[model samples]
Target: MTAFVLIAHGSKNPKFQEIVLKVAKELENKEDVKRVYVGFLMGKPSIEDAIKKAAANDDILVIVPFFIAEGSHVVQDIRRKVEEVVGNRKKVVYAKALGDHPLIVETLYQRYLEAVRE
Candidate 1:
């Protein structure tokens, strides 16, 4: 079972936390993924706690940054935090941000098409 830790910039607002939890719930439903845990750098259940909670087994861990760009959070902060927790684990993989994916472009295109058709 692989655990996916979705790291995002947490907000103080309760609604933002709710949204992140919703996304984690949806991702947990996917096949092959045993669990999806959401963590934040500046909010509750900080990255350290999230990692500790999920590192119970030798399951493959994948950290997905919720940032839109390869900025400081995705580069420096996340990398350092993950390295601290991962230690000698070889199954840990840090994934790219969702903004760089082609799916984002496709979604934008679909939105534009819908607007034009309206």
Candidate 2:
């Protein structure tokens, strides 16, 4: 089974975790995906913990950063934690941030429209 772990830069606000959970729920229903886990860089069930959980049940684990850019959080923190937890057990794949995707432009536009409509 292939499991996905979405890592986000956590916030003290409850809404941040809520958003990540909602995203994870959406991913869980997709075909070929066995499970989806949410991780926070600065909160509970951290990136390391999430990876370990995914590595436990799934043969392949995909760690996706929800960040906007490839900053230190992605380059250093996320990568380091994944490396430390998984080691050589499960096959691990690191996915790029949302900002790297072309759809992000459309998403931004939608957000703009929402603001303007309000």
Candidate 3:
């Protein structure tokens, strides 16, 4: 059973946590993914905790940093955490940061149009 851990920076704003959970929930329905976990660097279900959860199965585990760019959090913090937990593991992959994707631009444009019309 592989665990997909979505890591996000903790924010005082409740909306941040809500958004992370929403993303994790959406990923839960995917096939071959045993579990989808959400964690924050600061708040409850800390990044370390999430890593531990993903390490439970001792199988493939993917850590996805929910960041807009390839900053220190994704480059440094997440890398260090993955190394600490899954030492010489079978499969541990870290996804790249979400950057300038065409889908994002299109979605933003569509949302903007709706907001203006409303």
Model 3 regions lying over 4 Å from their true place: none
lDDT of 2 by residue, 1-118 (tens): 8888899999999898988898888888888776788889899878878887888788888888989989999888998888888888778888988765779988899999999999
lDDT of candidate 1 over 80-112, digit per residue (tens): 887798786747889998775799889889999
Q: lDDT tens string, model 3, 1-118?
A: 6678899997999898988898888888888666787778879888878877778764777788888889998999888877886667648888877777787788789999999999
Residue 74's lDDT within candidate 2 is 89
Q: Which ten residues in a row have the lowest lDDT in candidate 3?
A: 81-90
* Full ranking by lDDT: 2, 1, 3
Q: After superposition, how far is residue 58 of candidate 2 from its true place, in Å?
A: 1.3
Query: Could you say which candidate leads in lDDT?
Result: 2
Off by over 4 Å in 1: 109-118
lDDT of 1 at 107: 80
Compute each candidate's TM-score over C-alphas: 0.84, 0.92, 0.86
Give all candidates' CA lDDT scores: 0.83, 0.86, 0.82
